[model samples]
Target: MTSLVAGALLAAPGVAVAADAGAPPQPLVGDLSTWGSPCAAGEGRPFVRAVPNLTARLYGAGDHQPGEASRVSGEFEAWWLDGDGSEERLTFATGMRSDSTPFSWQLPAEIPADTVISWRVRAVDGEVASPWSTEGEGAPCEFVLDRTAPGKPVVTSADYPDNNNWTDGAGVYGTFHVDSPTDDVVSYVYDFQGGPLLRATPSGPEGSADLRYLPPAGGVFMLHVQAQDRAGNLSSPTYYTFRVASGRAPAAHWSLADAAGSRTAAATAGAAARAGIGASFGSPAPSGTALTSTATLDGTGHGFLTPDASVVGAGKTFAAGGWVRPSAVDSVRTIASQDGFGAPEFALGLRQEDGGPVWSFAVNGTRMTGGLPEAGEWAHVLGAYDAETGRARLYVNGRAVGEEEAVTPVAAEGNFQIGRSHGASGYRDRWKGEIGDVRVHDRVVAPAEITRLGSRAAQLRGHWALENAPEGISAEAGGGEPLKLAAGASIFRAGDECDLLDPDCIPGDWPLADEGHLSLDGTAGYAATDKPVVDTDDSFTVSATVRLADNEPAHPMTALSQGGVHGDAFKVRYTPATQSWELVMSHADAPGAAETVVARVEWPDGGQGGGHRLAVVYDDATDRVRLFVDGHADAGGTAEFHDAWESDGGLQVGRGRTADGWGEYLRGAVDQVRVFSGVVPDQDIAGLM
Candidate 1:
């Protein structure tokens, strides 16, 4: 047997191979022939070719065509090269048995775009090395990396149902569309100036996002939409602007008909014109026309001027007048006028008679006896004169009361005053009774005008009910809408209730009024111990016309409590020790953790007992909590916990907790207690005062 000497041969500095003489001489296992770029379609196969030594047997040979050999334990390796021949390994295999053996590898995720890879296969035996197969250059297969993202989302449509002018409290409908040509867009984020308004996701090929929103009560708002791709790329944001109006009014309904009308009008005046009347003008005017003629009168009150411009003619010496009936003959007077009776420009005169039992009229500052009737009853009177004619006449219920020679020409100013006079100064001053149908004529008003005024006066003698009430009171009359009882008086204890009359009826007791004042006896002690009591399910506003006494309590005391059961409650209170009024809010869900001190009030003198009006408004829209003292905003704050405090607890006006338990009653005179579901702005409060 020939001795087989085996020795280790160094292939490279870090690699070695064993060669045995008896095993057979090794073949050169270098110089792979297949490499270069694959086909454009990336589907072509690669193979290796090299000069083969047929004399050497491959040890890892198998039945497969690229024939495997036992000596080859690992995979055959292949790679592509740049034009410069810098090689990159594409794949690996164990062994290659034949000269025509092939090798293949799939593209990797990290491969660069447009790369050209080439590959080859090699075979090796225990001591003999088989040669590499021929190398194949693949057709250039261009690699593509995803570089696309979704484009900016756009607001395809936006609409405000009411006012269409983007005014306050209007309903908003916004539509968003996104286009992503290359990648799939998955989600979108919408941002609103007031808060996060909505979020949307793509539904299908032509999907859209929609939102119905209402603006906040006091400011302008903005909405934005942003789209994101599946790969986390975001599109630019799209923005829109809308306005919020001041008061509480329902959003107007929208219809295709209305839109068509607007389009028609716009088309006639160029679709770009923004302010002109729309085609929808054919529809009945949304808000009816202003007064035009007395024929439209309901006969319950004064009618509009008779459109005869001559009645309110240009340059005439005619004096016009009518009759009046005072609803309540109190010391203070009520009047009607061309300028809002709240403030007027012209005037008729009504004063107590000598007997103090009757009411008479003074026309243009001329006092006439036996011409005007009494107060608290329909009275007839007339003022007629043509200064140019030097004739003045006064009539009572169609009969002449007094007459005077023309002295001053009747003022020819366009404005006329009915219940009261215009200008800061006027001879007749203001009328103290409800005046009826007033008429003016370029010529002297005939006796027929006086007769017609008297007839109209007969029908205008009744009272109307108040719809919106303030805070803790309820009112009722003989027949009409129930008068709302507002807390317009001082805060009292559990025993003290409210008194609509006597302004000084507030005591340290809770008061309840159905028709009149419900006063606390002040002599007794009544307090609420547990949670504050409030009219459940019923909404209210708190108002007080109060005159604080010198001996009022100095500690913290509630002015109004707005919760009934063991749930959420809101309190408007005054702390004399701190010289401030505070609004405290608490919810049962949070236990003793109250979200209190929403607002506060600081008085310069540390007290507001000398007669002042205080009000607190709770509105659900903005969930605004506001306090007003003396017709001004004392404090204001907001919170958003809806339906958290809806329980059935009758309202408690002047004390803390309930009137049954712990007594922390108020001390002072209380008047009107009003409540409303809607928010009342400062302007309305000032008007009421």
Candidate 2:
């Protein structure tokens, strides 16, 4: 394992963070935990779990002497007040120094479940003891301890059988019954699709939960269930196994191409998922499709909700895909997902990893990346659970980007969602983008069908209207073409603008948009795409907002580089020895020297890599590479270097590769890392910063 050696580094100076002057007061006993985590591991009902040492506080303000408040004589005691106007003293924690704000106690283990009683505190100083703190403190605050676990729950399914016969097919909505062994059981814990455990609250007084589960595809499935009582105690788990024959039409569908703000949601083929209170509609979608609009979720708590979770559950084959346009890529955002009350079954979304925004399909929260998409650009994305192969697959623009042998997926038991997921903290990971034409299938869609879905959506190339291009993908944007970023958002351009109105717009020159970037770990970490950014023999431009994890590094590092044979054709790196940012080009594939251009400006005043924009431009005709700092070329002649050469290697972020293997890892973070095919004008490059 790589050590977090950077943890020993000091935080860089120059960044200001406001201190939180106001925060909640900590409990007197810092280790006193009230959450019911241990209950899950406790013995089933009728058996109580052991309680650990607990603590309490007594106010002795009235007992303290005026001048000597730090210490006092006598003892302090605590009591539990019953509802019947009677009190039973809590048997412990009796220290009597005025300085002792909270007294502690080691109560007997195995407190009876459903025990609820009020509490009081008293202190005595020598012979003059203070009155109990029950009068003015209003009704005594309740102290309830429940260590008993609930009885094991009973789980049954009617739609699929575990007899090993492949009968039921995919996309079938099935019902599950979770019955508690005890009446007080309030909820049930269940596992689906080898993902996280989920919760289903009992809607009836008899302690039962009726759940609707959708088999997304074909596979052998095992469902695990457990009961939870009101005291937050859990019972032993119950398990069930079932199987479904693969290949069937989807039972539910959601095409998010509804009108703007249309709360009356509808599905083109299956059950409809209702729009939320903050529903936004009629956003732009991809071209070349019958649909022209999409639903935009703002990433707060807004999304479409399907009351019944007729999606896929544990061990079921499933496939979901859609067109998405994100508004931001700096954080986690879910476009399509479903889950129960506790853990998530799956989510198709965006996350920042490896120093860039990537498209990932998660199975039980384990993300498999598809590719990278620029914010404000359009892309088709999909996730699949291949039961036959026992694998998880992800695709971007119809091309497989990532695949892995499947881990057990936890099944979802609550609801199907568009643009968000549910957890203990309510809805989270909401999508801050436009998502539509989402289809969930019972079987893993074949590659040809996946490709067909994307091709018909739109064929627009290169830059798009903020549809968000995934990073590190051999993605469809640029249609494998090349160009330069012209604005803050991605606008793929050659020189200035492509105007169809001028009747001179070239098919290959149509305007495409992208202002996305990639990230890198300064360690031995790096990212590579399938194609090179551009031929180094030709003019090209690249820029990124960069920040280093370590303010001061032990050695030099590269933010970006491309290779062909023995050496990098070009590299953008920070040389610690020179304390400068340099752009390098190799003179030969062998052990030859390189032509270098350095930025002459002092490092930005902000500490570490405080998001400084660095741009490298190579004008092949001029045989020179120009370096710009924060959008402007430093006045020093060192900013430009002659004798540039072409490196045909694919674009790599975070590290460079040499004849010696990969080295020069970037220890910092970078954003808005854009690569264009042609050199943009000085004014255009300046506008990016």
Candidate 3:
């Protein structure tokens, strides 16, 4: 007798020793079963469906069995059908397993979402092998993995008391509530002060939590919260930050961080400086800070504080500025108006009197006009008066736009009002839209000082105007970094030209309206950022206003791109052949490349030329890309582009890099090019227009 047969008979708990007459032992049979997979029912049971991320435990019981609990030694084999009509064998252990069942195996990893997996298992003992057990109600297992991530947590309320000075309190407490997208949220992680992340417990009500922390001596506190689902998927975090009187105290400052609330003075600036809140306060404007809010006004009412002779003395030089967003191109929206009608003191506002919206500064009736800003956009308006030179200057976006000389200055008597004009016509010329970071200085401020304030407040990474030419190196407005233009690029001043199709079609101000555009020669002309403006796979937005020159070409004209290789990174290209604009995102490995066509739109049949403002946003949380044309969602937009981008070269404008050399040069005028480090909301994109 064979040694296998002898051992089988001796070790068997209840089995009649039988020989196959030198032939293969009688085929073994038992029950084939699966566990752990939700779709699996019982022994020899068929599976209905399983999730792709799940691991199915397949096991089989031997027929000539030892005791029910005894370990059964055997070899197991399994196979499943692939999507392409091919059979793939599964790897199995040769030794019997002793967990749950005598023999068990886990299905392969990532079995494709929503795929029908038909698998069979058989057991073998030496030369004896059992026929594949029939699946009860035999059918292939189907599964669909839950690949979607939960929505971001909504920060409903974040409130913290203003801890003004060193005396009021050392620590401030804040309460915030985050509404989870689903009920499956296991917990929330609160990242405070960038220290060890803390898991928040359910506090007041269901979705709220309390946060209290002491500031780092003179520093402030910052809190960010993220939610985690039961499946271990984490939602994007939201942040809130509040200062604790760290910097120098201003003579008079209104942070305007109140949302539908009363305004207050900085504790360090003294309590007498609080400005009276206006009734026409609308909603909150973007403050750039997490916790603080900027007040919005509906062009009515006004906030006023008792005049501080030291800061607003008509005889003393003074500088005033704040962030403003106008709702429309209406006449005279005041920022600061002191001393009512009757040839008052000083009044700062955006006036359309000089044919269009201009930042106007008036002191003792002598007025100066600055560059006009588009409606529905934020602008930094600053005006400074030199008591000695008798000169009052207006600066818009940090550049001196207009200036005027005056005789000896005269001090006026009245309260300093914000957002409304103090005219004999009662409350006239109420400033519309939002205002924030309003400050007043007793001393005259230089041009360089105003630029520094604007730059610091904007917190921008790259702001390229492309106005400088011939070796076109323009200073970035947000930071005075030099942006080098190469390959025969030239400046295209809007000049005496006007594009009627463009909404900013005012013929007189067309030059300033479109400003200066960088023209590329459709060859190897482009501009590059000094540093990497955007990072690979980061949440960032690239926006530019592009006007195609009158020429039909065969190749694509790249307006802007990163990642030197044409086939491997983000590219905004316009193909003249098809009159189509496309945003392509691609990924590559040593093996090959894969691409996600983020968006592609053809110019409506006959529509061509003129300026089209295009924006592409990469939303980090969703791993998706969105395309906007003319301030709206493009025909092809909001698509998935999860490929990792290569950060090999500096961000380029007007051309794409390839193996040969620079190519896909854009033969057009590109202006107002901006790169931001986060997803630009739709409404903001619309305002870009």
| TM-scores of the candidates in the order shown | 0.27, 0.35, 0.35
Which is better, 1 or 2, measured by lDDT? 2
lDDT of 3 by residue, 1-689 (tens): 11121111122233223333422123223233434443342243333233322222222234333433423343333344457655544434446553235444555554543333443444433443433332234433333333344566666433433333232112222355666756656578887678888887545455545554434233566678787754456777777655544323455776666445555433224233444555333345543333245666666454443344334775876778877777866777788777634644787888886476778888877888867565665667887776756777888766787556674575775667677656665656777777777787655555655765553222246777766654468667776445688866777665446676788776532221245767777776788876577765556788888876645655778888877444536878887766777787777522235666655564622224457888888864346788888887754677876565546667888887545556888876777888876666677886654
TM-score of 3: 0.35
Across residues 1-689, which tens digit of lDDT does each residue of candidate 2 receive? 11222212111143121112221111222222222221111232122244433334433334223343444322223344345545445434354555444344555553333444333333433333343333333233334566768788777666765576776655556678889778778778887777687888898667788876655557787788888876667888887788876656554666677777678558766777777776688888665556678887777765555545557756777888888878889988887777765756888888888898888888776679857666776677888786655678888876788666466665655577887877777878878878878888876576776766664321222231222333323243446533222112122333334554667665332212233333344565555555576666555777766665555667777877776767787788877777777777776666656645555534532233246677777754234577877777756523444445667677766777555677787765455556765556677777765
Off by over 4 Å in 2: 1-54, 62-69, 72-90, 98-100, 109-119, 133-148, 161-163, 167-174, 211-217, 247-396, 399-689
Q: Report model 1's TM-score to 2 decimal places.
A: 0.27
User: What is the C-alpha lDDT profile of model 1 across 1-689, one tens digit per residue?
Assistant: 11112221112232223333332122223322223423223433232121111121223433223343233422333344445555455443334333343333333454432343332333444444333333233222222222344687755433432223545342222333434443456677777674755677767566445554534243566777777654355677777665555433211111111232343212111122121121112221111112121111111222212111122332344445443445444332323222322333223444456544333333334444443233434444455555444456656555565445444333443343333334444312333433333444334444553444343211111121222234632332234223232333322333335453667766443222222233332223222213223232223355644433333455455655656444336666667776666666665433344455665555522223334566666543234566777776732533343333554443444555532443445554444545443345557775543
Which model scores highest in lDDT? 2
The best-first sequence of candidates by lDDT reads 2, 3, 1
Whole-model Cα lDDT of every candidate shown, in order: 0.40, 0.60, 0.59
